[model samples]
Target: MTLPEAPRGRPRDTRAHQAILTATAELVAEAGYAATSIGAVAARAGTGKDTIYRRWSGKAELVYEAVFTETESGPVPDTGSLTGDLTALVEALVQEFSAPAAAAALPGLLADFAANPGLRSRIRGHFLAPARTRLAEVFERAVRRGEADSAVPVDLVLDTLAGAVFFHVGLVGEPAGPRLAGQLAGLVGRGIEAR
Candidate 1:
């Protein structure tokens, strides 16, 4: 007798997904991506290596998902004013980069992406574009409110603001406190100002 096909697209167990992501993040933080093997992750996650392989083809995909998952939520702070909103956004971005877990994983992830152009493309498509789109929405709102110029290039503006925050967190290695937030806000505000 022919057996009926198993149910397609079975709902994933949220707990398992979270456990894998947690295990992957901790491994990357402790050993860096290059050193984190699927076996190690499986052991840490209390699952079989086959389970991880079933979910992801390999380690890079798993690590990519782990790092990007941490920042899956869009960054859009509504502080009622453009300055307040931008300041909060930058501060949050800095916090993400500065977080020990993120800081440890991101550098390795970026290096891997550099080695593999395809992975870089995946990161841009999955992570960077969504972030840029969200920032563009904020810029659009500011333009509509007459707080920013409609003619400004949204990508350039976003890159400048985000780059400044990344520079501080990635390079300076210092806490991005209120003072840095205010400076970034001032720079972005000036760029947004109507000519």
Candidate 2:
């Protein structure tokens, strides 16, 4: 479904935008996503619902941006080798998913994804696409260097790395650290390596 973009007009106020995102994160953390509402977010942000609606389509988009967008901060690392690259990528995923906002918001965001097909696509566009694009470069390098199969399924590799961390941190509530990241990278790296 095509969601409406914010009307083209005066640029949004940076302070107000940050306030809305911060308020959304705080409310989702304090009350859980199921209980947080657009009204509550507006109240906490000290802005009206119209201000938020002008920027985002609904709570799902707002919450996803507030909680998930920050995780895409830096570029994915390239360490000259598949295992090394995977380790860096996996470590970042572990850290991001384990953060307080992500830890709290993921479950609810995932629920929203299940119920809203449009949201699922939007999230993939906003959140997953960038990461996947960068990761595709990594995979290409590995293949060129003969470290991985030319026909390796990049999506499965991504799913394995991301899904494992999501289950460990988001669902099991376990703390994943660099060690786990290294181990996961090694395991997946070997699996995808020229075999």
Q: What is the C-alpha local distance difference test score of each model?
A: 0.74, 0.83
What would the per-residue lDDT of candidate 2 be over residues 50-150, giving only the tens digit for each residue?
Answer: 99999998988898778866656677678999999998888778877777878778777888889988877775566577677777889999999999987
Compute the lDDT of residue 8 as modeled in candidate 1.
Answer: 38
Report the number of the highest-TM-score candidate. Answer: 2
Off by over 4 Å in 2: 1-16, 46-48, 121-127
lDDT of 1 by residue, 1-195 (tens): 223453433333455677888898888888877788889988888878888888886777788677654653754677777788777777767766776666777667767778987776776566567667767777778888888898888778767876787787876677777688878887888878776
Against the hidden reference, what TM-scores do the models get?
Answer: 0.78, 0.80
Number of clashes in every candidate structure? 0, 0
Per-residue lDDT, model 1, residue 9, is 33
When superposed on Cα atoms, how far off is each prediction in RMSD? 5.0, 5.6
Per-residue error (Å), model 1, residue 47: 4.4
What lDDT does candidate 1 reach at residue 26? 87
